[model samples]
Target: MLRNRVRELRARHGYSQTALANRVDVTRQTIGFIEKGEFSPSITLSLKLAKELQISVDELFWLEEDLDE
Candidate 1:
């Protein structure tokens, strides 16, 4: 599964969902979905998020391998 630190970063940056969404050019619901792991962002969007959060994509997102997998 795709694991992300979007919520953590957003909080650390003192940004609300709507604020971050506006910076990333997406709907607040999209930011909410991303935080909830209900959606995966495209590469471009991921880069934008990473940039806005002042971190690298690797730091923002990673793959979590399930034991069964």
Candidate 2:
């Protein structure tokens, strides 16, 4: 499954959901959904988030485990 390192990064940067959302120009609910892995963002949104977080897209998201066929 695709996993995101949002919570870790946000904690490292000392940002609450609302604060991070404002910085990324998204809603707090969006951040919450992203953190919970309940929603996958579009490429544009992903790039925006990475840019705001000052990290690469790969750093923000990655495969948690190999998928089984």
The model with the greatest TM-score is: 1
In order, what lDDT does every prediction score? 0.95, 0.88
Cα-based TM-score, every candidate: 0.93, 0.84
Q: Which pairs clash in model 2?
A: none
- Which residue runs of candidate 2 sit more than 4 Å off their true CA positions? 65-69
Per-residue error (Å), model 1, residue 64 = 0.7
Which candidate should be chosen as best, given lDDT against the real structure? Answer: 1
Residue pairs of candidate 1 with colliding backbone atoms: none
| Candidate 2 local lDDT, 18-67, one digit each (tens) | 99999888999999999998788888988988887789999998767646
lDDT of 1: 0.95
lDDT of 2: 0.88
